[model samples]
Target: ELKVEQNPLFLSMQEGKNYTIYCNYSTTSDRLYWYRQDPGKSLESLFVLLSNGAVKQEGRLMASLDTKARLSTLHITAAVHDLSATYFCAVDQETSGSRLTFGEGTQLTVNP
Candidate 1:
């Protein structure tokens, strides 16, 4: 069975600070993804960690993957109030094609 989990499911952050979100899985897979969502809004893709050691960044957010350890991380740098949102990590089992198993999202509140 494949399982995905994220830590610090509720985060209270201050502007200009840095933090890291972790994603752990119970199975072997090379595909992982990160997404963000505003309250009552749909998810927005942040990064796709396709292979081991793969890293991606956009603005103050960075994501990396380690398939061997079944782990992935989303790093936040110099957070701002506008960056407050719920973040999620998802994994794709190659045999399942387009199906994705998502983690319980991390809700981030960036206060100034």
Candidate 2:
């Protein structure tokens, strides 16, 4: 069965600090995605990595894909209180479009 796991389900981050969130999957996936969700708001897509060695970054967030190892990671650089939110890593399943198995959401708190 396909599964995804994330480290430190709850993170207390300090301002201007850097941290990396790890995501590991159990099955093969052609695409891996990262998303951020603010309280009471719909998720905002962060990164989409396709193929091994794919990487993408925007603002202070970066994500990478390693298909051979069935892993994907979300790295936070220079975290700020404004960046506090819940993050989720997801990957397409053997099924089809937008059908993804997701990790239990990670709650990130960036304190000033």
Candidate 3:
């Protein structure tokens, strides 16, 4: 069984629209995180939620955590071409290095 799950593996958002990505986990343990990958680029760290009600945002991306419910959300406000990429939310397995268990990944495309 997978520890984490994300819906709408592919998200096509408009240039000036708002959308929210969802991340659900099986149990409570390590922290949850959000990351963005641009094309062939590496993962860009967005948010690291250690506990419930932890919210963070930068630019057009906002992320919130709900550790009690085992859920997280990444909200995108007013999408743009530069935001077109893949977003992935992962959860650590409470290990020494805190290895991540990632969702399938959401591919976002912002069309003009």
Candidate 4:
């Protein structure tokens, strides 16, 4: 079974502050993904980590994965009010077909 855990389930920071959300999985996974969801909105894909040491960045957000450690991280640089949303990390197990196990989302609130 694959289990995922995310820390700091709720985060409150000022605009321009930086923070990192971590995801740890109990079993091996080949693919990892980061997603964002606004209140009353569907999830939006943020990043995809396909291999070990994979890293992707867009705007003020960066995501990295370490397959060996079964860990993934989403780093937010200079957070803004617009970036306030629920962030999630999901792991894809090959044996599970297209099914993905998601971590408990982190609800971020960026204040002025």
The candidate that achieves the highest lDDT relative to the unseen native structure: 4
- Relative to the true structure, how large is the alpha-carbon lDDT of every model? 0.93, 0.90, 0.89, 0.94
lDDT of 2 at 50: 87
lDDT of 4 by residue, 1-112 (tens): 8999998899999999999999999998889999999999999999989999999999999999999999999999999999999999999887746988999999999999
Write the residue-wise lDDT of candidate 3 on 1-112 in tens digits: 5488998899997899999999999977558889999888999998888878989989999999988888999999998889999999999876577678899999999999
**C-alpha TM-score for every candidate:** 0.96, 0.94, 0.93, 0.97
When summed lDDT is taken over every stretch of 10 residues in candidate 2, the lowest stretch is 93-102
For 21-61, candidate 2 gives per-residue lDDT tens digits of 98999988898889899999998998889899999989999
**Which residue pairs in candidate 4 collide?**
none
| Order of candidate numbers by lDDT, starting with the best | 4, 1, 2, 3
Error of 1 at 31 (Å): 0.6
lDDT of 1 by residue, 1-112 (tens): 8899999899998999999999999998868999999999999998988899999999999999988889999999999999899999999986856878999989999999
Instruction: Give the TM-score (vs. native) of candidate 2.
Output: 0.94
Q: How much lDDT does candidate 3 score? A: 0.89
